[model samples]
Target: MRIETLGINHSAQEFLAEQNITKLYPPQADAVKAGLLEGQNILVAAPTASGKTLIAMLAMMEFLSTKQGKIVYLTPLRALASEKFSEFKKMEKLDFGRRIKAAISTGDFDSVDKESENADIVVLTNEKMDSLIRHGAEWVDKIGLVIADEVHLIGDKDRGPTLEVVLTKLKELPAKPQIVGLSATITNSNELAEWLGCKLVSSDWRPVPLAEGVFDGGTILWNNGDSDEIESSIRGPPIDLCLDTIKKGGQSLVFAETRTRSASLAAKGSDAVFKFLSDSEKKYLEEISQKILDNNEHTDLIKTLSSLLKKGVGFHHAGLNQNCREIVETEFRNGKIKLLASTPTLAAGVNLPARRVIISSIVRYDVKAGANKPISILEYKQLCGRAGRPQYDKFGEAIIVGNANSSDLTEYYINGTPEPIESQLADDKALRIHILSHIVSNPGIKGEEILGFFQKTLAGLQIRKNTLSFSIEIAKKFLLRENLIVQKAERFAATEFGKKVSMLYIDPITAIYFKRGLEAVSENNAHTFGFLHLVSSCEEFFPKFSLRNKDYETLSTLIENKSSELIEPISEYDCNRSLLALHSWISESSEIHLSDNLGIESGDMHRMVETADWLVYCLYELAKLAERADLLEELSTLRKRISYGIKQELVELVQIRGIGRVRARKLYDHGIRTVSDLQQIPVNKLAEIDKIGPTIADNIKSQLKKVR
Candidate 1:
């Protein structure tokens, strides 16, 4: 179990010792004994905080010591990618005597990442890695190893197919690099290992013991047939449990089923939490609370979160901005926060563990089902794994708030096996997008070879052969009907349009929407609202806006006025609301203004704007392919306007460095509407405008001089 006994270099051993990781856990030792250091493919399915990360690091380090190829580490989330990137960067400081450059690529989908190609270790999200492969990054074939973190997400509906297909594609490479899949303990680890042709290492070993139980009527009955009496100091069960944990001088993580519940529980528990904070701690928490509210408009949600933070409690969910989330996570990790309430997003993978984990409810609202549904055992296990932090608690506690269905919960989650991870690649939409990507990227692949390629996938292995073939054929036919794929005798090929769509990293359905919308446009009917409606109607940018009764009159009026120019008739209220939001956004409305008027949060508004901008750029690219000269100029103008959230007249000025939507509007108001106007103005006079500083003015002048 010693680090030096695993065939790792001495420098790597020293690095591991510095990290206090000189001894390996049982599962890690099992992996090493199975020839992991000899470049064997491995699938390690173990409990959380069981040294899985270090096991993968050992393989990567040993491989890099003798090989001259890149180590591509793929994660499921951008936050996890960033965490791994920072960890790998520390290898550069080790005495390895080589430059170990590390790079990360996640959300920058449109850019050609040439830097990651030359890196010794590259960290990327699964989607980013798939896009890079579709764009045919030359370095992919030279990858020596791929470490798939959170590999159990292969069962996820939205993201699993991408991870499954990426692994299949990598396996097909001529180099045949080793793969290390790190996953939570699932029921079918051996099946997954057989699919990947790797050895399996499955264990339930935890560095810190986990005690799971159900709490009902001020008493928690442990799974070991023992019980503890919890004195309630708060009204709700969640706060009561939180107060119990805090009384024992341990931090607690409360998992709620929704964002609203998370915030409400945190606020309710803050009263009891405040009793534990010292004056100095209260002052520090106030400073952190101010940091969360700095430079942001005071919305109701921000106010609630800030108030909770003052009592050393915070809530986390997708609604908060990334900066606020980072601050809360750092504070909680530093042991400053007593109780942190959050939705299941933190359970996905962020390394924020605590001494106690309280599950407020096991049921979540299923949007598709239109009812509250119980969570899967895999998900419950993921949440429970956050209870024990290595190097922290001796034994972590996971307490579920019990109700009438407490027995079912205990039988299903506490004493149950995790479900087998089934491949979601069988979904039609997933297959359509990835099939086009594969054919477009590999021109030599023929129609006959398509099904053969898929047969190597987990989906192909799980489903019946005939069922898999039928699904593939259906997807292929759909792609051909949409003109994304063409068939000539026995060969299948991607059209020029299909190649562009694949490289653009958009759904094939989005491309079809653009094509139909562009074909219906005439020179006179082209307008900003028409194009905005087109992009918003696509599948990629949907679930656009929820229409309230009060806003229906306004949205209906806008839809009626633009009825003639819209590509698709605005029949749904949500569609109309989407157009109105985009219209306001491009009209240079502030985020706070949109939040107040449209009932959208700042995070939701930002996501909508980003998706719209990317779709507009795709529409512009499609216009070029369609050879519609009339639509080209309008699309270009709209693209720029959407990119900067500005009016059409401000597009040119917004393109200049140091000039944003606000500055462009200010210049326009002052009768300096164009670059020529900027060139003629003195720097000192330009600095006199509101919010424009002298340095920005100088930079604008410098950019204008270069333009001239």
Candidate 2:
């Protein structure tokens, strides 16, 4: 179907032409015929590399043609939100005959982000949209179109409930915004579309079809009944298939179960990949390899990744910092990296297609189950969707290396259909957080109205009514017991504490826990380590640390020595690992030292520091609410220390511009501990300090003068 035949506005047609997109894919044509341009809600469940993004853009362009109201785009991950934001920003160049604006909000969950209210389009993560509603973003009523990318996450355990509740809330908005849900192929599309009042346009079609098969040591048993001989290598099965792809002038994306395996296998495959790289390609990769190591914080992961990049392979995971990950992604996209070894997190992210896909393992570590299990068919589909490069390949190959489980892998993952997506909102922990949020946002909301709101949720529709009712009751009891909500005259309202907790986007339980810790810290005049220990207790923000067998004795003795300073005073061995690791961090320990002593790398340490900064701010806000302002001064300093990973003395020095943890440490070692010290010290002497040159010394002098 042609864009012109869809009867979209002239500007949308011209926009499509500029991108050389005249004809629509069959799935996109189905969407157009289903009234996508006429403002009907739609759920597009198609394979990856289909025209889903184009379908979404057409809907948005049609709505923007009227200039009646703004568009809201929601994604599940920050990476996707950024990708969509960058993609939508190009709409400004369209011949809309008027200016178009797009903005993104992903973090800092407390503020209202008034800057984005005027944007014609706002791209956000699911949690950010929920946060905006809680804080009452003024543009809620102005939203005319809401596009949810990765809509299948409504079935995710950690994230599904939030997406479910947010979608329900948006459906009830005054504007009646048209909702466009973009998803991977799932079995429950009809059910989900029914819940959303959407036209379900679901298909398994793709621009580049997949050839899925199982690769034993001897041959690949293709689904089409054709077998291809594979020469096994000591380099491993994944690298073997990857080399096969490279020989065909294509790239390969390999999914491993863990970060360690991702790196290890990438290294195992690097030599084979290196052998295939032309000299020019090797030279192009050498520059990227240097860039990977250039001006970045040295971590064990980065060093290993940089070494692999030079050999035409890369490893990707959450443990690598943003710069390294972006470098890996860009190189792979540019076709410089021949093989990418990654975890499943990348499967659900922005499109990064290769000529072939390989699954090194069909089993993964289920953290909750405490064991390894077979991968779901839906997961296999998601990963296999990355097999082919659209417009570049006629067909993509997805191979699973099955030695003993070859028949089971072929039957279960290749032939089996995806399980229906179910609700995780029936859990008590999920309900309590959102229940307080709904009540706080709509205070004095009656019990029936509140449960009625829950009734509108997907959980309310799919799960048993009686079970959901019981869960809601338990949630309400928890809120009341935790003093997050108060009841009067058959109505419910959030307490000031509850309001703060909800607006800060924290679990009510964490707020209650922090409240007790704040009171104890204020009462006892506890030191800085106490607050670090307290925030470290919340595993949602600061991740849990794994304790080594040798450390139990050391931590036990330290607990004995610092018992008066530790706020919680729970001497359990498992509880203090995060505190101990983070303590080693803020003490100005080197990355290698932290990795050796605490088993935390630079990327993980930095992530913890960033989360600690926010958690510290939360503690500061709650302290004001608790009237424990006495702890405010110390916490203010502690927040800065957490951010820069510095000690108390360098906290003052780090406040100066152009000085980070390293510079401030050098100054502190050189007897310049504060801005006043910089003012009093000679610029020449300050320049003599290690790593601080004359230019920085002069800049510090001028900054002090400005302060004066």
Candidate 3:
């Protein structure tokens, strides 16, 4: 079906046709024909850059026209949300007289206040939408349709719960608006479709036919039932099978196991490719160099990238920072640079399509163990899906670069499919808090009355026995015995306390813990006790910080230096566990001894750190909800000392803006520890403490006389 035939009009069709998108890809054509134009929910499974985005936009536009509400295109990443914002702008311009005002809600805290209110068709990350709905934004009622891009990410433990809740909340909406789920053909499309109440349009067909192949001994072996293998090695070297595909007028993407290796490969390939570019091309490279130096920070890696750009090549990874990654991706896509070596993060829904995709190492570094280990099959498929952009190239290539065991490569890459999508419902903290919020916010009577609600959740799926009894047990803890839940005339109802807990949107247990941490931190003895709490938090519950380059010996020395000041003595075991967690958080994995015969793994450290970081963020927010602002500020300061960045400075600025404890403390620390201390600081030095100019210093000095 043409874009015009679906009640979308010729102008929209012609806009696409003018860009040479005359015919839709199978997934796009199928979605449009499957009554998506009639406001039906759609689940489209197609490869990346295969015009699935266009399919979503068409559906969004149809919903906007037929309904009196806004359309939300939600993505998993801020970067992806930004990308969709740009794509939607083009559609907005081509919408004839029906102007759709679109905006992105990703950057800046102020974006939440401004864009979300008036957007006719807004694009936002899933987290932002999750927060919005939970807070009961007035604009939630204005939303008529939600397009969940990369719906497969619902399996992510950290983010999956939010998506699941958002979907569940949407189902509870009065209108029951249409839902569009888009993905790259995961293993269980039917199950996902059934869950969302949508039609599954699963197709292996691409507008551009993709020919699968394996390069064995410098020969390209096509999987098109050809008994004969084609001979070629022009791509570079058949050392990695993808090199053969590169020689055949196709670009290949090699997924490195580590950020360090990605940069190393890019660096190695740069010198080889410099000879290919002309003098003018080299000058175009210099232009990029100047642009990088102008816009981004002057880091050693940035400087190194500037030099590499001169040779018409570059690498990408998270370590390079956002600005550098964006530059590398933009340049690579424009064909200014060829062959990007990147980590699996680059595979997370970035629209960089390559003719051939190579898995240089399926095994990524295990930060806990301090070594490399094999990745899950789900990750492998996500990376390989980057190949085969529909309507552009005839065939896409995916190859695994491995050891002498060539047969093993085929099994891992070809035979492997995406793993089962698991629910994060088993998460204790997430479940307790969200459920409490639901009970509190809505007018509910009894604990047993809402047991059915728990059963609707993924967590409820795992209730092997006595579901009601288990829920009532958990609900009692959150609602409290005398708090708000009451058995009235055989029905349960939320008391005033239960209502407050729902609005707080925190687990009752965590809320109690937050209070404990706050109370412990706010006392006169807090200065010493705070550090102990922070350390213990890091060790057991909070995301652990890894200080790379600090060995066991080095940490032991540091701990010794602070031993007298610390509330409790630091031990070797504590030092090792803390260090391991920290390294994993920063993606710097190393091995450590656990027992005589067994050692703790590397990557596990980082995973633990990630878990800690997320929990900390949650707790900090919970503290604020509990009205423990002072404790929250104190903990935030500690968190900042561990993770340094400009954002931390901005946070400090906000914290100490006016008549606040932080401002008073800074004054006190500067011999202006109190209101009186503000009278004593040498005005010149005050200018150095960000946002406090000389004039403000003079004003502060004048206000000092009012001190009690």
Question: Model 2, range 1-708, lDDT digits (tens) per residue?
Answer: 987888777877887898899999989999988999888999999999898999889999989886589899999988888998888998877666678888999989989786688789999999999999999988888888999888888889998989998999999998899999999899999999999999999988889989999998668999988999877788877888888888889999999998889898899988878988989989989998888778575667777888899999998887777878888899999999989999988998867899999998988998789899988888899999999999788999999989877788899999999888998888877899999999999999998888898989888889888888888888998899888999998899999999999998988888888888876774646567677777887745666665678778877877787777777666656455677777777788887777767777666777888788889899999999988867888889888878888888888888788999999988888777778888998889888889888999999898888888
Write the residue-wise lDDT of candidate 1 on 1-708 in tens digits. Answer: 787777678888888889888788999999998878998999999988888988888988888888889899999998999999989988876556787788888875666587898888899999999988987788998999999999999999999999999999987789999999999999999999999888999999998999999988888888888998888764688888888888888899999998889998898888879999989999999998898788566777777788899999999987777777888899999888999999998999689999889999989988779899989999999999999777768988898899966677788899999999999998999999888998997776776688888889999889988998898899999999989989888788899999999888888988887898888886767567879888887888844766777777877788788777676666645464666778888888886777678866666666777788888888888888999877878888887887788888898788897788888998899999888888999999999988688989988888888888
Q: RMSD in angstroms, all models? A: 2.0, 2.0, 7.4
The TM-score values for the models, in the order shown, are: 0.96, 0.96, 0.76
Candidate 2 residue spans exceeding 4 A from truth: 95-97, 522-524, 680-708
Which rank order by TM-score, best down to worst?
2, 1, 3
> Model 2 Cα displacement at 114 (Å)?
2.8
Better of 1 and 3 by lDDT: 1
Error of 2 at 607 (Å): 2.2
Candidate 3 residue lDDT tens string, 1-708:
555555666666677776776666677888877778888888887766667888887787666655688788889998788888888877766655576688888532212466668778789887677667756788887778988988878778767877777776775688888888898778888877877788998877665555554555654445554432444433333223433444455566777877677777767666656666668878888999889788754555667778888777677765565666788888877766756778888899578878877677668877667887888777776776788645356777766654566566566656767686766754665565555556544554455546666566544554453853574466556555535455556455566544544444434554455445544443323232234334335423533434344356655665665555344455544544454344232221222231111222223332343444444555566566567665565556545433321122233432332533344334444454433345455778875565467877776655555543
Global CA lDDT of candidate 3, please? 0.62
Clashing pairs in 1: none
lDDT accuracy of residue 444 in candidate 1: 61
